[model samples]
Target: MKNYTITVNGNVYDVTVEESTGAAAPAAVSAPSPVKKEAAPAPKKAAATGAEGSVKVTAPMPGKILGVKVSAGQAVKKGEVLVVLEAMKMENEIIAPSDGTVASIHAAVGDSVEAGATLATLN
Candidate 1:
């Protein structure tokens, strides 16, 4: 008998394969295979800060910066487009979290950033 372990999507399972001799019957095992429980997802990290008095806005996921709709010191309304990020082959808009002036932009067009990396700041 041969035993093997396989893991997929954080879940692990143990399997056993029995060998049969030529023209002979296979043996049966009574013990059940062991299985490891799946692990839970990790918690998300918080956003990074910018300059003083500015509310930092971070990327929700890793992506390429596609467009920047606002500039530093520009006043933006709540839910206004601040940047466009391309992730998973789709464009995602990064909107302003609240009504405030764009204090600064930490990323530019065509830049790639990691999740929770600061994208901009609103004051």
Candidate 2:
């Protein structure tokens, strides 16, 4: 028999495994009840500079902003890359919706964003 201790989300548990000489399955071990603890509230993000524009550019999936390709007031064409988002170990280009100037960039490089969260805007 072998014993192991593991911690998950700050909760600790003991696990045991039994060696089998044959093909039979090992017995399951029940862990002790975990203590209930209150989780801390999430921190809020500060508002970005400039007001949001008429056309919103949002994230398709939750990811970290890898790069900001355009700055405020920069002219862009339809389908131009505005930001590079890293999700699922892949880089996705967030593009502009139409030919317009970049109104504002709500998210910066390295900022963690949720799906449908605003990354930038065009006007």
lDDT of candidates 1 onward, in order: 0.82, 0.86
What residue runs in model 1 are displaced by over 4 Å at the alpha carbon? 1-53
What number of clashing residue pairs does each candidate have, in the order they appear?
0, 0
lDDT of 2 at 27: 64
Alpha-carbon RMSD to native, per candidate: 7.7, 5.0
Per-residue CA lDDT of model 2 for 50-111, tens digit only, reads 76789999999999999999998899999999999999999999999899998888998889
* Residue 81 miss distance in model 2 (angstroms): 0.6
Off by over 4 Å in 2: 1-41
Model 2 steric clash pairs: none
For candidate 1, the clash count comes to: 0
Model 2, TM vs. native: 0.65
Model 2: how far residue 86 lies from native, Å? 0.5
